[model samples]
Target: MRRTREEAEQTKESIFQAGIELLATKGIHETSMSDIARAAGVSRGAIYWHFENKEALLREIRGRLQSFYKSLVDAAHIDSAPLAESISRAVRKLFKKYRNDAAFRRLQDLNIKISVLYAGKDSFADDIIKTEEADIQLFCEAVEGSPATNSCSPLQMFMIMESLVGGLLIRQYIRQELLSDEDIDAAVAFMVKGFSGIEEKTKTIHQEQ
Candidate 1:
């Protein structure tokens, strides 16, 4: 008997979910189509019918995360707020989602695992790096256009922001304790202020040269 469209989509979603869990917990190299089929309670044939291979399935997962990150960047640019405030708001929103959304958290965990385990050896890793560089460039352009003082270069500002958020996320992942919105705001403020003297320091050094 042939399955209806709805049934096929449902089966695909189940397989996708099971694949995420297994690949995340078991590591991508160790997980197989047969394992995903067993976890999804579907036959290997069904898994193959939906995804051509494990890499195809991983591409779909990566697409979802890319969309999620893109939305955050788009929303941050939707208004004329100061760069620091906009970044702070986006960071707080991200932490809130990580704390409240199980699927989002799982996807993040899976992405980190993939990057760690396959960074130099896989096409997926190259794609991940390209996506991240594109995202950072978007923010760098925003910094250049903003009215804020360029105490540091746009690229430097972006690297600082990325480091701050990435470090906090790793800390939260290990501690399993999300920081409060107020705390995040304070941290962002400090980061913004931390570079306020860079322009003056550079001027002093240039004068001495």
Candidate 2:
């Protein structure tokens, strides 16, 4: 029997949904293509037809997450905003996802955990790394156009900010802490303050020179 294109698309989506649930609950190492097939109620052959491997399925998940994160950054981007403001917006955007986007955040938490476990040896690890770096590059752009640009490198600033976000996310995952509105606000404040301190210190040094 020939399957319609729409049917195929639906099956693919089902497989992805199943894969994400399994990945979140079981972690990548425990979740397999067969597991996804069982959960999706599709045959193993169907899973293979849709995705070449577990990595391929995860790549799709990562792509969706990348698009979601990109939308947030695009919405928050402002030409005239201060770098700290831009960074705050981006961080706040992340916590918004934490509160609202469960699947993406699960993938995000798993990606961080797996990176440490795999240590750059896994091919799929690069997808997560690249996606995160590309997202943080938004803030790097903001730094480039900021008045404090001379104080620090935009790439360095981006790295610092991204690390702070990443660390907090990892902590949340490990501690199983729920990030409330107030918690998110405080986290954003800390991020803004950390970067602002750097900016101000650099400014004072420049003035002294």
Candidate 3:
């Protein structure tokens, strides 16, 4: 029997979800099409109909993750708020999502594996670099507009923010460290203070000019 379009789409989504879960748990090298099919409760034929191979499935997963990040950035009400407020809100939203979304957390773990394995010839690597560049630009703009960041150039503030977020995530994920509420609050406070210092320096530079 021929499946309806909606049914086809649902099946495709199921396959992708199953692939992601398996990739996260088993690592890409260990996961097979049959494994995915079994987890998804679909035929191996169905998996092939949806994806050419494991690499294709990984590409689709990367594309979906990129789309998700773009949607989050697009929906942020940054333009309506003070620069500091907008940035703070965005950062908070990001960490909150990291804490809550199992899929996101899993994807991140998968990404780390991909980065290590395909270090040289990976399309996902290029995509990650592009994504980071875009994020840095947005952060720079926000920092420049905020009263709390009057001392530093947007680029400097961007790097600082990136370091803080990256460090936190690494510690939380790789070290199996528990991230308590107090930890997040302290981290944010430290970031804000650092930004404020940069702003002061920027003001001094402007005054000297």
Candidate 4:
């Protein structure tokens, strides 16, 4: 029997999700198309029909994550808003997604594992490194473009923000606890205040020099 287009797409999505879960838990080198097929309850032939290879599937997953970050970048670049407000809103939204969105949580888990497992290795390592560097540049540029006073370098601000946000997510991922809204907000506020203080200190140094 010929499968309907909707059915084929549904199967493809199932296979894709299964691949993510296995990759997140087993690491990329340990996962196989057969594993994904078994987890998805589909045949190897079905997996091949939807994806050419594991690398192709990983690229699709990376692309979805990139698109989500791009939207956050856009949100953080609002011209009329204060830089701190814009950044806080974007960060809060991301933390909220981590707490509430199961699929997003899985994607992020897969991404973190991939970077840790592949760094300083081969092609996949280089690709993930370049992608991360580019993402950092995007956030830096957004910060630089903001109207609010920014005495610190954009890269400096971005590094601090990334460290805090990444640490929070990593802890959440490892501990299996969806952090409370109040906890998330308090952490975010602390980061913003720290960033603001750094900017002010930098400005004072510039004035003295």
| After superposition, candidate 3 runs with Cα above 4 Å error | 67-80, 122-124, 130-156
Error of 2 at 195 (Å): 3.0
Off by over 4 Å in 4: 1-11, 24-30, 39-46, 132-135, 145-150, 202-209
Per-residue CA lDDT of candidate 4, range 100-138, in tens? 989899998776776575566688766765666777777
Provide backbone clash counts, one per model.
Answer: 0, 0, 5, 0
Q: Which stretches of candidate 1 lie over 4 Å from their true place?
A: 1-7, 180-183, 192-209
TM-score of 1: 0.75
Residue-level lDDT of model 2, residues 1-209, one tens digit each, is 99899999999999988888888888788888999899999999999999999877766765765654465356446657656776588678777888687776787776665567667665666666777777767756644655456666877666666677778888888888868999899988887787678778877887899
TM-score of 3: 0.76
Clash pairs detected, candidate 2: none
Error of 4 at 163 (Å): 1.5
Give lDDT tens digits, candidate 3, residues 1-209. 99999999999999988998888878799999999999999998999999988977876755655543443244333567545445555566667677887788777667666767777865757766765677556545544555455555667665666677767877778876656777777777776566556657667778899
**TM-score, every prediction:** 0.75, 0.80, 0.76, 0.78
Ranking by TM-score: 2, 4, 3, 1
Q: How displaced is residue 199 in candidate 2, in Å?
A: 4.0
Count clashing residue pairs in model 4.
0
By TM-score, is 1 or 4 better?
Answer: 4
